[model samples]
Target chain A: MAEENLKGLMLPVVIGKLLAPLPLFPLQFILSRMVRGIAQRRPEFFARLGSHIDSSYAIDVTELPFVLLLKPNPRNPELTAHRRPDKVASDASIAGPFMELFKVLDGRGDSDAMFFSGNLKVSGNTEAAVCLRYALDDLEGSVIEDLLHMGGPALMPAHLLLQRLRRLEMQA
Target chain B: MNTQAITPNAKPELVCPAGTPAALRAAVDSGADAVYCGLANETNARNFAGLNFTPDLLEQGIAYARGRGTKVLLAVNSFATAPRTQLWFDAVDTAARLGVDAVIVADIGVASYAAEHHPQLRLHLSVQAGASSPEAIRYYCSEFNVKRVVLPRILTVTEIAAIHREIPCEIEAFVFGNIGMMSEGRCSLTNYVTGTSTNMDGVCSPANAVHYMDLPDGSKTAGLGDFEIDCFAAGEHAGYPTICKGRYLSPVRKEPYYAFEEPVSLNLSSLLPDLIAAGVTALKIEGRQRSRSYVQAVVSAYRRAVDDIAAGRWHDLSGLVALTEGGKETQGAFQTKKWR
Candidate 1:
């Protein structure tokens, strides 16, 4: 194959692969940050949303080894925008009094960020870790962004953009 | 402008959890103004073994409590599904028929139904409802006419004060027992593993699936299905393994860590005055599955605390530490948000 022809094909293919995640990347980024902001600033909203979580019967998150628990403050439930932290834990290592102690000590006993920093530990399962992380990421990004945008300009777009970048990484 | 004429008693009511008929009587007799309990079925959050009141027993329990000037709050505080909606509905109806003071509900559908159909019945929002903010509380109050809210185990005294300032309904907060770190209304940990959701089914770590094995190391391992929730060393109290309270291994650190939470009780005895100042109406004790003796002891201690506070007396509640999970207790979200 000629060098010119090969280069053209490779560029398009590479561009196709690279740009594929672009739209979603920006969206995910914005969404994730929006979730962060909401998690940090507007916990009451998160708590309210959590209270209304779909209760369909399924698997138990407690059984998983790694759990990334994230919810807005229960006292104030206002769906807001921004990136929020998570409460990350391994199921095997931390479960009861330890998790409670960590929560009370972190000064964010109710904040979702405690789970992400490994203050709370899960013990046995690894898939739980991944799923919990992804679930939290998704909640921060997709749920907050969508809900805020639908709700009103009470949400900041530029703020969400920065948050998106912080939450989601561009594919290398 | 007779501001003092209202004279509202802001003294926090000791809300005790009654897992059985006997526990109910113990709580009521021990100076508990309000006693909360769930049904025998998985419709309540504490769906543990050898706990909760049957419909017949609930009637007797309510009568017993009411006759003693104690209020009975029936906790139907769990999720209801399409298939199980009837059970929850029936529970509510039965609670109303049994002359209970209020029915604690978490589900939107259930709340709406109770509000609409049982216009005369009083509805209290469950912590499982997770209605934490002023707006959310207001929404429930306006929409469903919910009279009181069992606030989640998350909130500083200042935060509670702020919320109390804005909301109109009565506020109840947990003062002792299992401090659920997860958002009460939205958590789905139970359903994710055992195919049963606490939010919907009102059960966490359902009994049939929970198993315990005494390991050779003098530590007992508790499991749900094939998953190991926790391993307790001998001489240390081993709580039944629930997913939220399970132990886990962290990749960042090789040591096993409590991923979700530990078995710690939130004892806010030191903050009783602060809670009273916050205009709280009730202080809840979280143990419906506890023994009657446990109920009596905890309730009596809390009752004394409430009276002492009201009488302008100050005493340390640290003496009750042995009653807490792992023989430890913390202020929960009442202090700073230092959740480590």
Candidate 2:
């Protein structure tokens, strides 16, 4: 189990290292389009957030150089990447490694377990963050899994493939 | 009295939980014999913001679960405050109207209302009812026609066996998840700070009142309302600041200690046979605030465990301890008489 967790930690850490020095504009453009796409595709999911539908969220991947500012606005959602320490106003902020946050979004990992384990940290309006967690939790299918399939256009495929192999090793 | 018989069924019912329609569906699909949930109101004990179901969604959930051979139990469990008693009545009316298999109720007033009005609806006493003895259990059975009494989590198996031999109604015991100090329906610990409670308002340390913040020295503290209940250094496990589970500072203790109860979950996997021996007619997993994955994982695990035990086998389920608060699990006064 420990080996598998370490292996799961590797891809995101390695990816963060690889992408750290890269320019942010293209990534920001991809994020914006994906955010709008999600808003269009999953309006009902966003609606489940209830009063927090328009709440701003900061997804700070501690291992990465940039953070994501997201507003799950029902009409016009926004997700943008910005450099860390260059603050973005948000109603709530969830900081964690990329993989753990991805796991929480997809329901593969328990957010309570993550939060208690100190793997996932939340600050500023914890209720809003919790509401977001529930909304993501009840999402019909894994959002990150869906995004991975979409992201597998290249690097993500290799990374996830390695993770799956490590899981197989653990089972063995 | 339809005591449901004291013969004890060949296998205990596996009662699971769901906070939303999706979780209800997942619980049913994961092989829950019965799935329990509540309305998006104070009538539900887990009245978290954005959790539980609106009546319309509950209708959908019932339709889906019933179609899949799963019983949907409606929880109208929170105590009804004065003048607001009608809300609880309306919830019972909604349950009867929705054709739920049973209504788990905590308040005697709510149970009486359900018994008088929705006479056709099956009534299961909620654990919040805190029926731990034959006398209380029989009172509910005689007065409200309660078919099952969910025992408080404070009973030892031997004590339960003793009660089981005397009670006329079926026995339901909590087998997993949070264990309180067993003060159910009367504990004012959370209300002292948050001004809300499980029995009255169907919430403990309500999300709006619970906060987590980081300190300057890189420690995280969990607070309920205005009180900082517990603090954790890095890598230390943290739990929600529900007053019962929160640690506190006392001048008597050198350092902080669990002044109320430690944040540990109850896991009764190893005691399943013992619970059956004690004539537990059903096993309840208590987690309505959890996600679909949680429902699926726990329900599926217990489903397999119960089926295996029925087929004359047993397997280790200690892995489930990892899902608990502070990564700790206790039998919680089930095997032993020890609990906070």
Candidate 3:
């Protein structure tokens, strides 16, 4: 009877371990979809954010790591809104170009049409934002596209599950 | 601008440091061909209390330097984050409007702005930019029309020679003052301990955070935040207690050792001829926060050495012993890679 009980428990554990990474795909998909939804609703919010970024300004962003927004001016578009994920803060503002820029970046996984459409914004000073967008789009369209495309939407959960299964395999 | 083709002079420029109006005059009168200083704020790296000059003082300093055939370069080298970028922008605008010779800059954003707004003004890449590689140097030069690049302290004389061969602009190396082992423009160890950041804020071991305690055993203890930097014997020299330069106790060794560098000043007087032969265009003496006396002495000694070498005289300047840090000096990386 004990042997039978152990076998039954073992089957579920094995199955659960095998299916663990499966959920990560759906989770990422949902997150990406939600981000897309937000981007579709508000395009101008992220567009105007860069106008306010100053060199001496310090923002305490809670939702994201404390990244130096580094808005040099509303004129130069070459400066991208780089986010240093290591230094996140809580009290920082979420309005302007940052909102839409991050949203479009987050949702790029959903659909190309969503990205190509006016759904994504290069807000603030459009000339400067366009320059920043071109740089990012070029970089993304080049070497990085392979990785993002290979993963598709399903890569997220598969990656998570693979990590867990690999750990189990190591133990076994 | 002089459009005529001119042969290069063997005597390089004598770049000096000035903190206040008095220091500026002292540097120029004592024979500084050029003096670099900043306004009294975080816009400059030497953001010390009661140091630097005001806008009025800066105008006077420029006039004084011009009158003495000495050029003045305004340093707005500190990195500006956000909201505070206006200060840097305004500083650059004011410097250009005042007909300053050049503005020493390190921040990419600041450089970009200066290039766009003030095309007539010449730009010199500050040491804080950390453009050690030829590629990096080229990028700055091509992007901002940088006339000169201040090589960082980490590169050896050989490396400097190699870089000089590749670049078209003038190369200025630090001949005297602090020898920073840590990477410039990226260090945050001091900021982690103290609120003031070395890269962005331009102030390291800011006075507000430093505390010194005189111990009973004829030793002094320097503390930053909760950590003790070093405990110096009363007779031993008490130096600037920075995190990287501080003595530490490790599990492998019980005795305290200088993990980075011993508190010593970099004096390259012995390597002047070698540096000149290496194609260095100018010699810069650091310490804008230092007093006029310090500036006068260091500048005078270097000026004499540079002039003597140009005049084809056999000069030995090792007599500048008292002016060194802890009365000890090194050739830094200029002589040999291994300083020992």
Candidate 4:
């Protein structure tokens, strides 16, 4: 996709304003359960991180209302949300559009390809981000599938968001 | 009457790299004749934090490959330190016990131990062994019964053919991957600061000591330990921070330049026919530390090239440029001597 096409997918001002007052509890609850399921599915995912198992990652979707903070602590894996103004104490940050980052997570695309194409921007601890990419690359299952299945009614808004993404992709 | 006879050489084995179980499957599915991997220890050269396989994972990978008639070569290629001789020996023993097709070894001590303890195991000399000459190659073949030798990435195609004519064992050459200017199994220059070597400890610049900081001027700085590798402009492709590959200053030159070598991947794709004619037994794809996507793309591309050569079909492997380091590639000393 073109740079402008992807950049345009960032949450518009109107949507951001609408989601500003929305409670994060439902999304947090859904994410917590998804993390539990993912942890159970791929137990070695965290173990694969080696020394970076303790490091936290900020998975940012450009223009999105909230960013995801993931800590693959094998004992107690954590995946929480942090909106703007809430500082994310992360070791590394990987920022891209939702679909771009989504492609990497679901194994449709790779970090190297995404990075080289200038779609994804990685900052902060380079090594830790690399370890995370290595771990994620080794994932055989789909993270999107895990999320979609976990969220029933709570995922309706997310489902609508996916439809919007698809339309934008079609327009491109 | 003038007549030239043309008989294509037998198809050389396509040895793909496997960083993880997923990568192993990707290789096998993509028409690899063999897949090489190392255990998740200091046993292999690519000892990155999250790379390599566990014994259980290896077992699964081996099983998956075996079902598809793809051979598995386990690499216990790192030097066996005095304190950790048992670890290398145990790795060799595991290879034998697991029924691996062969074990790639570099260190003489490790080879001797494998030959002594596991006489039934097949030993392939790793490039890290630095067995470049016929004498060195012969010595290894005689002492350790090495079936094949992965020639270092520093030899010209003519030199490879010359070595092949002289050596008793089969020859394996690197067809594509990172172009290391330093000698194989000797990742030492700036390693004194890091207290590790990719050849032994399996880390060049250890991950924990690496740092990347964004500058106020829209440039980025990469630091490995106390040494700052390079400062890249905002849009420049940021490479991995290995000191030797980093640009540096000098008294004579106006600007800092790549003293060692640039980050160009070794791509010997166009020389597939020359390699086959030269009696190369196998073609190894480097990057066991790279992702499964890399494994899949590279292996499949080479697979088509090799197969096209066999079936007498048109082949274009130029699309693989996207996968190479910084989108730049070199045949690296394969076609000509880069060093005097």
The most accurate candidate by TM-score is: 4
Task: Tell me how candidate 3 scores on lDDT.
Answer: 0.67
Supply the TM-score of chain A against the true chain A for every candidate structure.
0.23, 0.82, 0.24, 0.78
Local lDDT at B130 for model 4 = 83
Interface RMSD (Å), every candidate: 18.0, 1.3, 26.7, 2.0
Q: Taking the tens digit of each residue's C-alpha lDDT, what string does model 3 give over B35-56?
A: 9999878988887554566687
Off by over 4 Å in 3: A1-172, B1-8
lDDT of 1 by residue, B1-340 (tens): 1112212366667788876665688789889999988886767887654456668768887778878999998888888888869889888898878878899998888899898888899999999888889999999999999999888877888999999999989999888888875577787777777897777766777755666565677566778866888877765566656788888877798877788887778888888777777778888998776555567778999988777777676665777786777776888778777754
* DockQ for each numbered candidate: 0.01, 0.59, 0.01, 0.55
DockQ of 4: 0.55
Rank list by DockQ: 2, 4, 1, 3
lDDT of 1 by residue, A146-171 (tens): 44554467557735643543222221
Model 4, B53-153: lDDT tens per residue? Answer: 88888898899999999999999988989888888899998899899999999999999999999999999999988889999999999999999999998
Worst 10 residues of 3 chain B by lDDT: B1-10
TM-scores for every candidate against the unseen true structure:
0.64, 0.91, 0.64, 0.92
Report the C-alpha lDDT of model 2 over B168-235, residue by residue, as the tens digit.
88888999888887677778888889888767898888888878988788789999888998999876
